[model samples]
Target: MLQGKPLLGVTLVITATLLFAINDATNKYLLVSYDVPLVAAIRNIVHAILMIAILGPYQGHRLVQSTRPGLVIIRSVCLTVGTLFAGLALQLMPIAETTAIIYLSPIIVVLLARPILGESIGIVGWLAALGGFAGVVLIARPGGGLDPLGVIFALCNVGATVSYYLLTRILAKSERTLTLLFYSALIGAILFGLAMPWFWFGAMPSNFEIILFLSLGVTAGLGHFCFTAANRYAPASVLAPMTYSHLLWAGILGWLVFGQLPDSWGLAGMLVIAAAGVAVALRTRFARR
Candidate 1:
């Protein structure tokens, strides 16, 4: 039922997943030594600079062109807010747990699309979303030693991400990919820059920290680029399951980097959430048939 260069798309998705996993782990490590807002601000600024430098000449003035400026700006805001929240959550929570919770964004987008995009969700979709939420609850259970504030931040990230995805759908038909990508980074940089003064710490980062800070932008840029490129090669349905590989990468990196592993409940929760997200994607795929 799925079409396009499945092999290439699958490979790109897997690559993107791995990069994103590494990005998350790196973010968590840096957040441990720096304030979350400062980390987010610097990351966004670097990302914005890299994107503009690489894409500006190719896109020329059309880089910023958008048929739907309002929606584009709103989408950018969502991305920025989501990044900040996720950074905060990573500071207080384990990488694997934070990642699993953030994975709930795709499921939330499925539900949110019903009202916001006038898309319909079948009974299976509803059940899958509930199952995903139940998984999140397990991971965030009381006395689990997880920070309550971190969990809240994770949920907030999910909310903003859902909005971002929804707006992406609305803008995809009218806006160029570079245009959308440009705005996402530009707005994030501007917003983060505005808040930098308050979050800036006087402590100087080590050279290694500086390298990781720079790689944050590199990974984020390349990850999204690969994911977007994959879509051009295959249907989203075919690539959707590949995204689950992120959990595996996250788990491995979390263990290697922080010596932290998700416990039984947390592991089970991650699995359930991953399964539910795949289910939701499959449901949408089959429905289109």
Candidate 2:
């Protein structure tokens, strides 16, 4: 029932990618001075509050209602763990490289879909998946200068993300988009918020730090909103390739905010991953037709 507006959808998705890149940069900056739990707690708390204030009146009981409550909770847990891993990775690695590694999730999904979802990926899909893994090896190659622990965290995030995406694929058939989004924010807020006292030992955030902390939720919430809204205007095929724009934005922000740029090898790895992901997306689209 959604209207087709490909151009608008592309714009919104690109905007979402930029906002998310900014959020990641902000997270990396804050993680330098704060623990992962505290940072994640504040981000989700603000995000939950914003969602309630904006969607509560309009959505009412529907915001919390889910026919697949258990699966929804599982999905939310995946997101929560992914957030923690991502924060830990950002704390130790450059944003551009971390983001590139995290993107391995899509490729991982392709590899798993045949066994898990019973969808055949064909020869091209297998090759693309292999190429994607090779790209990660390049990024994490010996003498690449990346923190090994950070690479591990990024890979952990990829696992969480692959599970999240698979669950989303199953649940999308039965759930409303807002319900899923709200639960993700709600669960993250509750889990991290409960763990805050132990991780709350840092110096009180400065006025500017508080602002940055608050902006985390704003940017994240807006990015999700834009991403969801974009789906209403464009098909998944159009949106899929556009998601790769995140790497470009991440690289730019990483340089501008953190003065960090990926080395040539890292850049090449990112391009390979992007190319493979695009190939997978386009192949899926054509296969569907």
Clashes of each: 0, 0
List CA RMSD, all candidates. 1.8, 0.8
The segments of candidate 2 whose C-alpha lies over 4 angstroms from its true place after superposition are none
Over 4 Å off, model 1: 1-3
Query: What lDDT is obtained when candidate 1 is compared to the true structure?
Result: 0.89
- Candidate 2 Cα deviation (angstroms), residue 39: 0.6
Q: TM per model?
A: 0.96, 0.99
Q: Per-residue error at 239 for model 1, in Å?
A: 1.1
Score each candidate by Cα lDDT: 0.89, 0.95
Prediction 1 TM-score vs. true: 0.96
Model 1 pairs in collision: none
Candidate 1 residue-wise lDDT, 1-289, digit = tens? 2346889999999999999999999899888888876777787788889888898778788988887899999999999999999999998999899999999999988888888889998897899899999999989999788999999999999989988988899998899887888788889889888888887766889999999999988898899899889988889887898899999999999999899999999899999999999999899889889
